[model samples]
Target: MEYKNNGHIRVFLVGHAISPNRGSEPGNTWNWAWELSKYTNVDVFAYPQHRKEIEKFILEHPRNNLRFHWVTLDNFDPWHPEKGESGLRFHYILWLRKVYKIIKNLIDNMQEPIVVHQVSWSTVSTPPPILQGVPIVWGPVSGGQVAPASFRDFFGNAWPKEMVRSWRVSFYPLILGWGRRVSSLPLILAVNRETEALLRKAGAKRVEFFLDCGVPSGFGLPKPQEVARPPGPLRLLWAGRLDFIKALPLVLMALRRVRVPVELLVAGDGPLKLQWQSAVQRLGLSDKVRFLGRIPWDKMKEVFQEAHAFVFTSLRDGFGCVVLEAMSFGLPVITLDHQGVGTFLPADAAIKVPVRTPEETFQAISEGIERLALDEDLRLRMSREAWRFAQEERWDRRAERMLALYEEVLSHAHRRV
Candidate 1:
């Protein structure tokens, strides 16, 4: 797709956690930045760890307008093994200072007006460092979404700790005072309704709703075809980080309740893998579950094609990208109705079960799985709907929306000046 830069709008996008070329799965930010650059001149400030990887990507999949600047500081990385999460948070402020310096210099030197856009780590609550007299666009920021209080114990060993950590989300209102410093808040885009509501309540002048992730190029290769659920068993696929928030143990417990024979392929790995594996043993579902840990994103395409349906057990999600991926592959999704995934679910494409107590949750999911397994017509219908939704939400479409939003912000900012 060719984008004519008629306005020649220059955008400085701050994406601290964005690593488009870091691993096999270039996340949403990578795809977003890549596509957005096609439309406008983008200077992306991203993590340094992905510097080499991004350089290689630019060589292979060249985008002349998109320039990547690495944001590096000694001993900085939120996920640093030694420093841990707390250390990363401590340094995040410093990182912001570095970003501010770079933006300040650019604003002073550049002839064309610059607009600041925060592309990744979408959260409406946390106010980024202010660039005096500059118009700022915040979010599709989405961190305020949380699992229900009743789900505290379902996270296994990390239960209460994870639950306790979630309480920090409430502090978002206390920090809204910081946003008052922003020169012009043209728009604050939120990924989900919950996030949109939070931003408005926190005194955001203008808040809009938009999804953070869109289907990347070259994914969802499989065409829709009649899938037969064999008389023997139902084939299901579950993919994503195996963390407490995933609520995967409930999946295992649900499988135990399923009367129909079901085979599950588990993808991705995290600290909770061993615990979930143990739970599989305890539930006597070892034979039914296959742990395909940490597979590449490409491999997931094949996995999706091989499965009859997809099960997403995340208690909370900032727009589950995998749900869209599964839909693109023509797999009907079974996910919790209490998250961002539920908010955008295509009509009749997903089985939305409420988040309930552990036992009830498991029962609900197991029952839904059973229904999908037996009803071939329902599965086929849902798969088609899912595919339709995915086709409509490609990254290019999302980039167009962003380009329009950027233009609006720039126009409004120019009027004030």
Candidate 2:
């Protein structure tokens, strides 16, 4: 295990959307960088859009082995609408030829020795050119590699709602494309079992379990009510894009059914903001619902903490990082069972809603509310359970596991040498 000749192992983490504006992804990026830094020299190579944030983050948290390198994209990476993603799939791949060399040179030029590791999304098409002999890992929670379509007709069409759903329907195809792009590369750390299976199916030689999302023991947020919040007006907080996929209307309808005086604090702004606001006005729930646009990450804990429970009504998520965040604060989540993250969560952290257009969500929310209200003991139990789980999955714990893996991977590399 003498790495004396190997010199120092350096891991280059590439995350395109690591910026302040992108709260979700950067949270993941910072944790990945922080974790990898523990085991090896981690140079955080990210898109330049986040230079300021990355610089600020690194300064606040200086690490011995971990470094941050932000990659500026003169032009955004290719996506579907840019002349048919499927058509230029092979052409888009050619861009990766450069990716390989840039990384390879870093490996070759290392004073002692080095290793390159990828944590999340890298815009490059194939394995970095220099990684031919190196162990490269990409994606624990790859964006685009989704499960097989149940039926061609099943996916939401530009439903009348899509026009008004306050979501980026256009991004759907792009999200899909991003997956195929990442899956093409070799993955060293697969975020979850589902993603691991996909990476293997796509021909990755080796994969490891490394969750893309991490949670702190506490986000400086208040714990959810030990008992449901006294049963009067339900202050339902619906954070995230008010877009189509979130099925906001179903949330609206579910709230609408509740005779209880309920208020919905809809946070996070998106394209269909006005449309959703208008719909709420149309439904005459003006007093019942309020749209609180994007709250700062540091302050988000307040919104979830103040609320009785966290509702993740989204049709999908990589692993619902927010869900983990919410649970870390001791809030129970009510979400759909169909998606990867939903099923992935411990049953104790959530109330699973059967996926149905509006009826199931409606009944589920209503039932969840009533159950929480009627059984304070149950609410307290769930709250304690969620908090315990999140602490167990805290970033520090996750990072330790990652460091162990890097040691193993590096050990393997040294043996080969």
Candidate 3:
């Protein structure tokens, strides 16, 4: 699709982390700036630690319209922001203050139309820059999704932390007065239904739903020749940080219950790795599961290609980037039907089991796995549908939507005057 620069609008993206090598929110920020730059000028404000990788990437593949401004806090190592929760929050707030000052000055002198977009650390808990006069887009942000209390067993020692997080999500908006802070913004983009509701409740005047991540161009296209399914156990790929919120134990327990032969390939490592490995042995899944610890970003494509289906068991997420990546390889998904995964993922492209009591959910997941393993034609059809859905979610398309939103915000602001 062709996109024209209708207004010659310049965008200043305010993000704490922006990098070419990173994959989560940082990579997302870079992708947004890169794609948007194709249509208009973009100035990115990001942490200085990512400066090396960002500069090297731009050197290799140049874009004249895009520029990066490194923003950092005094006396603190931008590379290692304090490790604990409180320290990180304090550091981010300080960084945001520094970014706001720089952007405010730049906007004061610019002749062309400009908009400020907060694209990283997409959470409502942190207040956005309070810049007056210019239109500011606060999200696609999310922090509203909470892990189910019934599933606390899956979290192990982290259960208490989960409880604390839920409490914060419930009360932070009122205590911090987010409603008053966000009411003045022209637009706020929400990544999921939960967050959208939260924003509206907090008195955001205009909120729109937008997915937090998108696939790249030509990512999910079909290969030259379709390889026939090899004869073996159904290979189920599960890739994510093995933290408690991921709920890998659910998958392991479900794997044991599946009557059909299946093997799960886990491709990430985290604090719960040792505990999860022990759970595998306890559940007699040593033969059925393989932990392929922390595959590099570039190599993950091959891992996805080898697997027959992808399983995402994240209890709380804005949207799992890995789910989109898996679909890009035409892997049908088996995941819980909640949060972003439940709301955005198409039914035909996945077997989304409803979140319920632990035993019930486990039974449903096992059933979904068994059905897919036995029916080759069903899997193939879902694979095709998944690939087609992924194509529609290309980053360029997302950028186009963002451009339209910018125009809308400008029009509204103009009307107000």
lDDT of 2 by residue, 275-366 (tens): 87897889887888888998887788778777766777665455667777777777777776754555466787678877644565688877
For candidate 2, report its TM-score: 0.74
Predicted model with the maximum lDDT: 3
Instruction: Give a tens-digit lDDT track for model 1, residues 1-417.
Output: 433467488888887766664432236667767888877788888766556777777788887889877777656445563555666654566776788787888788778867888765565544676667677887777877877878777766776676665777766666645546422467888777777666666677787777777777777844665656556678999998989788788688889889987899999999888988988898899899999999887677788888888999988788888888888888888888865886788658888887767777788999999998888898888888888888767888778778888888888878878
**Is candidate 1 or 3 superior in TM-score?**
3
Q: Cα RMSD for candidate 2? A: 6.5
lDDT of 2 at 326: 75
Instruction: Please provide, for model 3 over 222-304, each residue's C-alpha lDDT reduced to its tens digit, 9 standing for 90 to 100.
Output: 64115557888999999999898898988998988899889999999999899899989988999999999999988898898
Looking at candidate 2, what is the lDDT of residue 202? 51
Residue-level error in angstroms, candidate 1, position 72: 4.0
Ranking by TM-score: 3, 1, 2
When 2 and 3 are scored with TM-score, the better candidate is 3
The backbone clash count of each candidate, in order, is 3, 17, 0
**TM-score for candidate 1:** 0.88
Q: Which portions of model 1 show Cα errors greater than 4 Å? A: 1-7, 17-20, 23-26, 73-86, 111-113, 179-184, 226-231, 415-417
